[model samples]
Target: MDVSVFEVIGPIMIGPSSSHTAGAAKLARIAKDIVNASFNRVTFGLHGSFAMTYKGHGTDRALVAGVLGLYEDDEAIADSFELAKQQGLEYEFYEINLENVHENTVKITFLLEDGSNYYVIGSSIGGGQIIITNMNGFQTEFTAQYSTIMMKHYDRYGIVSEVSAILANSHINIATMRLNRNARGEEAFCIIDTDDIVPYDVKECIEQLDGVIQVQVINVND
Candidate 1:
């Protein structure tokens, strides 16, 4: 595994613990990014060490701060709960045991304004690093370490090829891609991590392709 300078020397963040605070914020931020919609409520299922010491370690505040789109280093993290209330974001945290996962894990459930709900399960892997283990109902995994694109679409032949072709045409180098489907001819999920940033128009092109139902991108540099 490649380690970043932040991992080795620790990230510059407002934190009592890197795993609990900074990583929690990062995970929440990425989860918010994937939704790409307004969510009025978010429920947090805390597990293991996170459930045990979250309040004291400022993990709760960090998570709320991130959902508010505050960076990890932002001083506003100290007052995330109040800020969340002011911003019309409702949140609640519950302690729960998760199976076969890292110690610092949290399940974020989002209730969007459109009467739809989404969920993401992620673990803070220490030193401000995080790995998103699952999204919606798909058993997907990604670190969000690069500019990532995630989509849900109908399962059918040529969808992947067409999307990749668009990426290739745009000169986007795909570093990794994962495809998953619940069953043949059913809904599917695709995650593509690119070495270079993908332009908005390229994403729009993919969306216009037949079979694509939804697409969301996370530009790490943003």
Candidate 2:
């Protein structure tokens, strides 16, 4: 197996624990980007090790900062609470026990301004790396370090190929793709990682495709 340089040397980030700080920030930021909307309030459900040392280790501040779109290495991570308060982004945290999950897992729930809400569940797997395990209620695993597009659509033949064609037409190469469905012929979700940044127009075009329900283009690299 070939290990990348980031895993070998760790990431450029603030705070002490890579799991609690960098990973937490990335997880939250990705969740925010996934929704691609603004939320007036957020809630963090800390599980396992995160619950034990979050406040002492600055996980609280880091998580909040990420929701506000601050970088992992941003010094503003230290002042996230104050900045959030000033920006009218209310937040809260609580501890909860979950089964068969990584010790650094967190559930971030965002309550959007229009009374809509969504949640993202992920784990900080150390060395500043993270895996978003679930979105809304779909079981999935994706890293937020790349350009990705996730869409919800009807479970039908040709949907995956349809999305692939669109990406290709936009001059984007697919790195990886994962698909999950609630049941056969039911609603499905697809995550596509790309070699290039996904344009917002590309996302709009995907949304117009037949059988596609919703589309979210996340380009955390930018």
Candidate 3:
């Protein structure tokens, strides 16, 4: 039997624990990407394995650096908090129980400029694979391994189906998806995971779609 791609490379990463460290970083990065304004403050809640060993395993630092837009392979991960401070970002950390969630999971809440706020819950499944379990109180999930992910811009008269249709036309197969909208419904975002590797051409095509203001590729080596 042919091994699924996820099965082959899902457990290895440059960290003490693939789920706690790498997963935490990916989750923080996703949250950073979705916020429209500059992030001024961040709060992280750790659960399971993340809560148990985040400090020792460098999970906390990894997460902090990721939210600050640093890549997984960045050498500065160890000094993420200091770096964030230098960049005028502030953060706090805490431990919480998620009630029946994975051991290596965390919740992050961010306060951005203009008084906007966002929250995210995510888990690191061993290897380098991570799943975003929730965003802004919405039950959703996404894999960050995709080469291209379309993040919908918040606006009135937005139709999510149109975004899906555009991907279908491009012959892209969506592996997973997660959506979040503000309580007022004035702001919204969708994180899409696709099977097709994203190239510049494909990214440009998606950016042209209505309501899509940005197409970002989050990867370790990008």
Candidate 4:
């Protein structure tokens, strides 16, 4: 099996435990980027080890700091709650049962000021590594290792071929690609992990394609 640079290099963080601290922070940071808006409220559904040892291990603070767009090494993480209060960000924690997940799993829900909600379920699978298992109710996978593009489109013919052709034309190499949908003729989600940086022009090109409803890119450094 292959692995990402992140998996080998590990997350840059101030931590005694990577799975509990660094992984939690990365999950929140990724979630914030995906939402792309200031949060109005947030809920962290802690499961298993996260629920039991989060406070002691600083997972709670790390998660909140990530939501505030803080990186793992940011010392301000210790004051994340007060900072959140000052910024008028409301937050709460809940212990829940998430069937068939790792012990360091967490389900995060973001309520944006625009009245939109996004759900992300991820797990810290040890060694400062994490994988996003679900997003916005879609059973998909995301490991913020390479530049990634996730798009929602109408389940129709020619869309996949058109997108691929455009990437090929731009010299963008797709490292991996996956498509998931409920049924035929419905909304579909596509995740494309690329080997090279995906420029704004590439995203603009994809967005202009027919049947493309929404497009999101997670840069490698993000």
Candidate 5:
């Protein structure tokens, strides 16, 4: 028997552990990307190893800096909390038992300007990989490896079907999919996982959709 490349190689990520370091960073970065307000405050619910050895391993600061849109390799990670304060981002930290969830896991909630808020539950899988288990109130997952991933804001119309049509026409296969929305239901994040890497032109096409706000490629290599 043989394993698929993705199964063996997993994702290309910056790392200490896919589950502890890189995944944590990616989760933070995505949380920042989805929120509509400037991040004024944040809370982290750390569990297991994340609580036990976060500081020694740089997990704590990595997550905080990530939510600030900093990458895993950024040298400022160890000092991100202070940087956050200097940048007007106030944050709190808490320790919790996630109740049989993955050991290296976190539940992050943010308070943004304009009185809006968002929360994300995610796990760091191992090599530098992460899976977003929930966002806001919606249960969802995304592997940041896709050359191109399409995340659309919520719309009442047939958005999924329409987007599917475009991908199908281009001969792309949907590898995995997850959907999430904020508590207010005013917005949603539709994450499309695909077998084929996203081509530059295809990204441009998705960005042109009526309800789409931003179409970005998570450069896994970077």
Candidate 6:
């Protein structure tokens, strides 16, 4: 598919650079959705361009605001630190080396109040577009342009068929699918991008499957 002009021109956001500020915010929001729990603390590992200009470009503020559930264009992003403190969301930022990734990239680790944790790597590829490249050490790539389902399951046979069948039955068309694993027949990650929304009940259906360990549904709000 061709990249749309609007995507290249970028969406409405408070930014000096879409890659540094807007995309950073969206990356945080993506992590928030995956964590899907109350915030405890978060750490952002900025790389390359992000590390060099985050403070001046508001990348750091944008990230924190996003974790607090703010969108990229929200004006409140400038006061994200104060907002975080008010909500008791502790956060920190650091410079890190992400070998072979985009210059505008970050690795975020989230600690939930419920004691759950999540790690994600994302890069802003300009024009407010971002790609999630890794989740929990699974190398992958996805743009948050469609409703998505991330399933953690045992790397055994029939799991893919089971999930796909459910989506098919629900009349949801799969736009794309990617799977990664730690080792054969071990823990695996499946990302399914669908053309239409997958309802909550359908998610529950997949969660009930024998080998499915967890399911997270992210609706593309943008």
Which candidate tops TM-score? Answer: 1
Per-model C-alpha lDDT, please? 0.92, 0.90, 0.73, 0.89, 0.73, 0.90
Please give the range of 10 consecutive residues that has the lowest summed lDDT in model 6: 30-39
> For residue 29, what is the lDDT in candidate 5?
85
Model 6 whole-model lDDT (C-alpha atoms): 0.90
Candidate 1: Cα lDDT at 45: 97
Worst 10 residues of 4 by lDDT: 3-12
Q: Which is better, 3 or 4, measured by lDDT?
A: 4
Candidate 2 deviant stretches above 4 angstroms: none
Candidate 4: stretches off by over 4 Å: 1-10
User: Better model by TM-score, 3 or 6?
Assistant: 6
Error of 2 at 219 (Å): 1.9
> On residues 95-134, what C-alpha lDDT tens digit does candidate 1 reach at each position?
9899998999999999999999999999999889899989
Off by over 4 Å in 6: 1-3, 114-116
Q: Residue 135 lDDT in model 2? A: 91
Tens-digit per-residue lDDT, 130-185, candidate 2: 89989998988898767889999999999899889988898999999899999999
lDDT of model number 4: 0.89
> Each candidate's TM vs. the true structure?
0.97, 0.94, 0.73, 0.94, 0.73, 0.95
lDDT of 6 by residue, 1-222 (tens): 898885768878988778788888988888788777676899999999899999999999999987888988999999999999998888999999989999999999998677877788999888888999998788888899899999999999899999999999999999999999999999999999999998999999999999999999998954
Give the distance in Å from residue 136's predicted Cα in candidate 1 to where it truly belongs.
Answer: 0.8
Of candidate 5, the 10-residue stretch with the lowest lDDT total is 6-15
> What is candidate 1's TM-score against the reference?
0.97
Residue lDDT tens for model 3, 1-222: 876675666544447655666667767887787553577899999988787788999998989988987766566777888998898888888999897678888888898787878888888876667777786665666666674474656654645677677778888787777677775546676677777765566667767776665666553245
What lDDT score goes with residue 71 in model 2?
A: 81
